[model samples]
Target: MVLQQRREPYPHWEYTDPSGAEVLRVVPERGGLVTGWSSLGRDWLYFDAERFADPDLSVRGGIPVLFPICGGLPDGRLPLPQGVFTLAQHGFARDRAWELSALEGGDGVRLTLAHDPHTLAAFPFLFRLSLEYRLAPGQLGITAQVANAGEDPMPFSFGLHPYWAVDDLSAVRLEGLPAEGFDHHTMAPATLAAQLEALGEGVDLLAHPAGPVRLRGVAGGAAVTLEPDAPLDLVVLWTDPPRPMVCLEPWTAPRGALISGDRRLLVDPGGCCSLSCRYRVDRGWG
Candidate 1:
């Protein structure tokens, strides 16, 4: 493995395989975001560097870490036993900076996020989040560890929103997802297939695959299969067409799970919870 620093365009850590067939670039200050990834002679991630240049905008591409909560709360308020806290959509981990370090005696990188004043103000808990990222010939794997450093058990949800590049949105198809799901567009239950067919508009729905999900592009394009670990197997499908991209997000719980107490995961005090997921890529229509 070869690790180098690239300053142009932006400051990020670039790691590559000796074979030079795989590459990954990450920006720690940007929520430990994976800005770009390439394998099998093709770029798998869709990154909007133009928008990324502006600091005020939320990242439109790359893999954004969702933590503490999967989605927004009622009026951005989380009524915990401690008190009522204002937690934004997807929590604050994705917006705050993270510390990045090379894996010790390993072949990848590790990014760590600890509790800060801002986070405590929102979630009111001391926690540590460590993410280890690695790459192979045609795959990317991530292992996430969340530790509750406080004296009380912490209730939270975790997820990863990865924007994948494609040749054509209309030509993309995903297998292994449930046939029905809640559509965020209309805020109603709808068929998953029909939601995906609206290429001109967009899609934002959570599908409970409860396992792995496979996505394929047009002929001669890219194919990706996402296999998430238990408690994080649900997939959120999203796309804003005309950009040739789609986001297959793996989530630990459905939106509003924290308040609804539906499938919400908890970490005991002084205990850590570990989860993992993998993405395998290739070239093919199906």
Candidate 2:
């Protein structure tokens, strides 16, 4: 299994197993995004080729890295000891480019990004972020590490937003979530039973205990399993009506953590923290 470099619409790395049972592509130039993953020639990731072509538009699909802050801030402003800084939804890491640091055998690749002057102006912290993507026979593992390089402690949140390909949003069912969660739009109370019963257009839950979340009843008799190393504080379930895709997000904190201070990660100076999650596909599920 050798890693192949390709230059087309953008620069990317591709890996294919010897048996041709799996293939994965990563775009280091686009925030180290995993653009595609396929098993048995079946794509498991939802990506918009048109949106990806536009350099200005943030790619709507794939696994987008959410760091420093997982969701939106109150009024898009973060209050710090120094002052108030304007931070956008999901932070700035996804909008910036990440450097490809390592390629492990044919199964893994590592990308790293650090704070620069532009990042400091908004985040006011010195930190290094590393993301590693590894592929197995039937699983894809994502590991993220954030190192605080500043003298002061760093406050942040992190998450992964993956758009999964589904045949029908109405036919999907998610299990292993907490009995209750919170709504993203209204911040209203929500429950696992109600979500399953209603199957609403969109829903968001916060602070779920760490465990394996499973999605079953996908089109073509497939299923997806997500297992995180630690319990995530937030879980987001959303999809657009009439679209054959849904996003199951895992977050360290809920939206507006910068103001609520709820589940925010505080890394001490010279210290680091890490989190990881694995996605497995079951092709024979019925």
Candidate 3:
């Protein structure tokens, strides 16, 4: 459907049906943040225009896509140009307007974002990124693929940030993860890695793993499953102390300064990087 831009409390473009079910929201020229649904939620999502607005802040369990890296930078400075690679935190893709190339049939909607000379100043590569959100009978599948369109190879990383609401935080349970995992605090890199190694597959409260992997509330319960390939090795769960929302973040790599020796992924010509996950909700689990 041809979506129209909406300007009000916040500058955004919305696409929906006659019944007012929201499909998508594109915020261009500000942060290139898209808040809405390609399939799931079908209600609301959040993207920030100001990176510095919360340089040390991030939301809980909703899909927030991180292109280059995740988490805050030391000294609160964006780790590009001055760091090893020039790409900004989370890269430049999230800061550009993606063209809706296709939204038809059962294939789903395809949003494409490309890089030019300006972006190359930070990333230094010609590339195209496509995000596909496909909806089927009872599931929402998300696929993020990147292609190197430049003559040379490209290096990058990506993450998914989806904020999910449970009947209540106290009632939600996360499964398949250990009771203790790794902690990636800025001041204690060695300690974090050691803790990660110690816990192995255990859930680290620092990483926020809630057992049972199910959300429960007075209304009902919902489930989330993450199946990422070799590239993605970490999952993060975040939530506000009293809010009903939770964010599930899957990452290809950890987010940190370029020199930290972990924030890097190289994509050769025609190379691609992708991460996928599924979300489903059921009633009466509370």
Candidate 4:
């Protein structure tokens, strides 16, 4: 079986593994967003069907790439040494269109979004953000590369928000994280010692440099492993009620990086930095 790539009528690109047991779909015109992923005939990623149909609405599901800033600033504006600019929550990379750089033999696809006048006005920096989506035997790899194309150094944060389908929120338990994480909503440190079972409210686990995290009890009796690479310092666990999905996000910095300047990565002029993670899905021992 050979890998395959096709463009569909819905106006998106689809990539499938050689055996057809895995599939990945991306919409380049819409933020180069990956809207669907399936493994072993099971849908592993969640898509908001209604939002996918509405062009005016932001796609709530899939893996949305957050760049320049992960969560939010103190207000709706960012204060840089150059000047202050108004930025939106979760950054603008997810809303803007990306150019398809390469789709490699169906096993991987690389898409890029470079800074333009519109992005410059909001972020005041020249950068190139490249995202590559690759599929292996039982894993999916996402790599984000940030290049500082400006004359001066650039400060930014990034994250990948993947809404994974689950059987039930109460049935999910995340392992391999410390007992404490920061609460972005309350702007304080919190504990996750007991909230794993009753996380209907949601929680963000501050980054642990120790190791990867795993989400058990996913739909179809499968478990997903999140193995993050360097510079990714945070893992956010959140769920949207009545949606049957949970987000295991890997972020470069915690919330309020733009204001607090905590753990934010600074790329020197002509230098580049990258953050990557792998998600491996396998049958669970139910």
Candidate 5:
């Protein structure tokens, strides 16, 4: 799928699978929406908000989660990183335009975004983000491949922010996680020894009777459940003040800055970090 840009403002590009079965519109001004996923009946699922209303979450949908490189510099009160001059929020991957590299596969579409000297100045690493949005028989697979093209090893964290629609948050029951791993984002590692133990046997989210998970209309509202394979260590469920969407973020990094304070990575100009996951939705009875 290739979109011809005409310098128009709202929608910068558009993508359609070979059969034209699914279409995604990229709007620079409106936050890219996987606008049409008929395979799943257009039930809003996926997250990237233009602006995170909660002071807690700084990233919105379709935004490349970046770091050295975490959301808006600590406390919205610091100069840009040394040797950097770009005006992007956290990293340059999200703000800069992404080119559609390829979409001719058996499953879905693949998009690529790369960084150069200019982007390195901000995040200090030569990297390529290849995002693949693949739609298979009954699931939507999302994969992010981060390759380090710089000479030095890079140390960073990453995650995905997808907003899914739900009937209500309170009525939704999240399964497959520890009942007590809900510590404050700022909790120190040392202070969590006890708390971590208190969280009885980790919840096995992948054990739903149907197979992995089950998202149904609970108590008159909708619910979402993710039964991810082993690598996804944390799952964050979020919803804005009055929005109808819920964000089920699977992360390799926490929301805030790294507390242990260690930043060292060796890329040798060709290292990479890749994360992949998928979600299947079966909206029960509208």
Candidate 6:
């Protein structure tokens, strides 16, 4: 009737809210990624165990944390005031090990990652990030906090990439998208509907909608709704056919935010910003 927290085998911490009918698997060492989320006896996330088990590969599934930069910089280099630093795509947050601990009520877990010598060598900034995850009934929530620990302002973009499970990619009915969006592959304007139709061939597009996004017709008969807080409402839809997974992600900025400074946010010294989002489930929405 309460909740439970247990360390599973290597690198995984399990959190289950028995009262809420939800279960989650967290891997602090794997970018604080939520490798699994289950509700109402059905798994809502897609995970690739093989890639996840290998430390040298970028995880194909689960929710990978994106920070400092969402996409990539020119030639994989970032020119800062101090000097030019080599940062790979999506920055180093997703590759670093995080410190994990249970929340005060034992109802959730907090995973924290801070800058170290290795990160400083690439990012040249003093920063700290905290991710808190909690579940209740038919809902799962996450609160991400970023602090600027350096003397100067910190420019950054943050995002979460969640791979949702879907047996038939064509049956995925996603609503609440604007009419137009940007295609990641082509870098051209496109209609969101067209992208959904091409799911079988593979689709990657980003859109910004005002209200909650409704996702239905997954493998199971259940429905999911993503509710993201302000400034983090940018939605990106991606699919790799034959994998049975579709990623409906929330981002604070589009690709190249840091490079172009478009919608990029800056946190002043000693200041912190908090962003929160939640996902709710329902039945028979198909």
Query: Which candidate leads in TM-score?
Result: 1
lDDT (C-alpha) at residue 42 in model 2: 82
Displacement of the residue 112 alpha carbon in candidate 6, Å:
0.4
Residues 1-286, model 6: lDDT tens digits: 2334455444577777646567788888778888888877788888998777888888988899998888778899888788888989988899989988877876677899999999999987799999998877667888999999999999999989988887677788888888899998798999987898898898889888898998887657677889988888898888887898888888999887876888898999999989889988786677
**What TM-score, over all chains together, does every model reach?**
0.96, 0.91, 0.68, 0.92, 0.67, 0.94
Candidate 1 per-residue lDDT, tens place, 1-286, comes to 7778899678888987767787889998998899998887877888899999998998988899999998788799998899999988999889989998777745678899999988999998899999998888778999999999999889999999999988788788888889998787787888987977885489899878856788888225768999988877888899987777889988889878878999899999999999899998877545
Name the lDDT value of residue 76 in candidate 5: 35
* Ranking according to lDDT, highest score first: 1, 6, 4, 2, 3, 5
Evaluation by TM-score, superior candidate among 4 and 5: 4
TM-score, model 5 to reference: 0.67
lDDT of each: 0.86, 0.79, 0.53, 0.81, 0.48, 0.84
By the TM-score metric, which is better: model 5 or model 6?
6
Candidate 5 residue-wise lDDT at 153: 60
User: Can you tell me which runs of candidate 2 are displaced by over 4 Å?
Assistant: 7-11, 17-20, 197-200, 207-210, 231-233
Clashing pairs in 6: none
Candidate 3 accuracy as TM-score: 0.68
Residue ranges of candidate 6 with Cα displaced over 4 Å = 1-11, 18-20
lDDT of 3 by residue, 1-286 (tens): 4456776535666555333432655454433445544334333233333532453554232244576556545553444433534545565565555676435653345677788767666666678877776545334566778788766756666776665554555555655555555555333323333442333233222343333244333123545454444455466655544555556566666656343657467778887766565544444344
The residue-by-residue lDDT of candidate 4 on 1-286, one tens digit each, is 2433454435567766677777887887787788888776777888886678788887778898887898877678898899999888889899899987445666777889999989999998999999888887679988888999899889999999999988878788778878877666566777776557546666555545468888887887688989988777578887777788888988888877868878879999999998888999887533
Which lDDT value does model 6 have at 257?
A: 86
Which residue pairs in candidate 1 have backbone atoms (N, alpha carbon, C) closer than 3 angstroms, thus clashing? none
Question: What local lDDT does model 1 show for residue 123?
Answer: 90
Candidate 4 Cα misplacement greater than 4 A, ranges: 1-10, 101-106, 204-209
Task: Give the alpha carbon lDDT tens digit for every residue of 1-286 in model 5.
Answer: 4444434323345555556555454543222224334443353453443353332554444323443333434443323234423333444454455555445664566666677666665566677777777764346777777788777665555555565555654444444444334433333232223432322322111111222444454222444455454333355444453554445556554433333232222235687766676776555533
On lDDT, the candidate that comes out on top is 1
Q: What is the Å distance of residue 171 in model 4 from its true position? A: 0.9
